[model samples]
Target: MYSRALRPCLITFQVHGRHFSSTKQNNRRVTVIGAAGGIGQPLSLLLKQSDAITNLNLYDIVKHTPGVACDISHMNFPAKVTGFTGPDQLKDALRDAEVVIIPAGVPRKPGMTRDDLFNTNASVVRDVALAAAEVCPKALVGIITNPVNSCVPIYCEVMKKAGKLDPNRIFGISTLDLVRASAFIGQAKGLNPKTVNCPVVGGHSGVTIVPLISQCQPAVSFPQPELEKLTKRIQEAGTEVVQAKAGAGSATLSMAFAGARFAFALIRALNGESNVIECAYVMSDVQGTKYFASPLLIGRNGIEKNLGLGKLSDYEQQLVKAAIPELKANVATGEKFVK
Candidate 1:
């Protein structure tokens, strides 16, 4: 059970100066499993700009995967770009990878829900997880596949069966929900989105996406009806983009940006940066669910601490209550798929 009376403590860190290093031991390799896809390409591009990565491995079954890696390699960054196409090359791509991010999967059409993407994306995630288990079992893995609520569990189940399960290391990338919540709240309150911080919890799906506007860093208030509308918009932002694109795509650009943000945060944490924090869905006892998304304190070993849900409003409490059953069903779906 969550302690509704507890408020999350703010963490602050100071960096006196910036330092750049290129030693062999300092090298960090990151792998993108679906590098040629809509989210993967842009995400790989963003990560290529990072100084923390020494190698970026882009893997996909598509012939042009190497081409995508080549395109990103031209950029003047520290990370060396490598492309691995098809199953035969996946091991090479994941070899020595410190962090692995999976954005490989199909996108949603106008009327499709994230759950509708389960069959295709779940298999993609499962195959990648199997390879990761064999090649880089200890690497920090981030799942960006659709129906993330289920796909995350599939990855975990695979890793568990392989006897390499690390609940702290595997995460369902739910940062996009927080990103949308902050952006929507900022838009509604006429505040700079970057300045607004909203903690989105629960699973990554329709009603399961709970944005704690009451706990937003800069306190904000809205009429009850307005609050409901804002929450709904944040929950369905992906669908809004899908409908806007008219079946062409589904929130690829923004999802890429959010994915890159989460990946960078993980990199920072792995580098032993202090006070690093982010929200992600992972195996937890919080909220009595097998998996839940909440603010997490990221450390050198992945999740150093699970910052449990703090001080929910009555409305927010109800939202969380409504989410549990759906989350359980989603978890069951993923676990059943693997079995």
Candidate 2:
């Protein structure tokens, strides 16, 4: 996992039920599993800064979870931090959570495909999902675990078995894909990355990730060759980071930032903000795929509406067609995990 301790140089007001944001009045409980890992630690730190989180639970199989919680508790945020370790504490961690973000699982190593992580991560997600189903079935579950194409279905199937499946309440954190797509596209077009919005659809794996650069928010133009190349870059960006790490680990920092972005957006929506939107991989009939990533309007009850893939150019359409078979295989692989 991607856990290097970046300096905590954040600024805010004095603590004890006080925060800098005027809109920080929501008293929602947020739980993070895998709080000791690379992505988990930074993600926990980032979540600690959120005004929407009144209670933040950090749970991990690792014994150091409490230590991580203790570290984050000293921050100048209103959210009270608590740590829960191992299966014994999982129920407590999830007891009343309104949002659960699972980043638990092994990270990809050099030369390892996301599918190579299937067996290990599938079980991790299954256990977590079952726990969520048991204790907080209505929590907005955003999955940050890998092999997401497979893991999300595994989580959903477990919920389904428990008779607690709410397709709208479960989501795969495909925010990283959209984040990368927007940044890369913005860089290509000399636009502000923060202002760029690119809808990345399809699943969360290699070939399954489809970045619709043609539908970018600013309505920019790209030549066919450039578009094709940029799309490929976005699809393979995860692997690109993994390889660049040279066996250290996968893309933890960027993934944490993207995960936090998605979590905050969901929290805002849950807190009654209107028009909150983000791209997520979720169960969908969109494009006939059992699960697909698309832009979703998040509301009080999770996904208000799935804004299906808008308009794909001929090349984008070709990408979707090419991805279907592989995506179906991934879905089957996940659905088979419990059965």
Candidate 2, pairs of clashing residues: 2-38, 3-38
Expressed as tens digits, the lDDT of each residue in 1-339 for candidate 2 is 001110111123223544433354568899999989989999998889877789999999999899999999999877999999999899899998999999999999999999999899999999998888889999999999989999999999999999999999999999898789878988998987776777788989888999887777667887788878888899999989999999999999999888887788778778786667777899999978799988788888998888788767888899999889998999999999988
Q: Please give, for residues 7-48, the per-residue lDDT of candidate 1 as tens digits.
A: 222211112322222112346889999999999998998888
**What lDDT does candidate 2 reach at residue 301?**
94
Cand. 2 TM to true fold = 0.93
Q: Which stretches of candidate 1 lie over 4 Å from their true place?
A: 1-26
Alpha-carbon RMSD, candidate 1: 4.0
List per-candidate RMSD values in Å: 4.0, 5.9
- TM-score against truth, every candidate: 0.93, 0.93
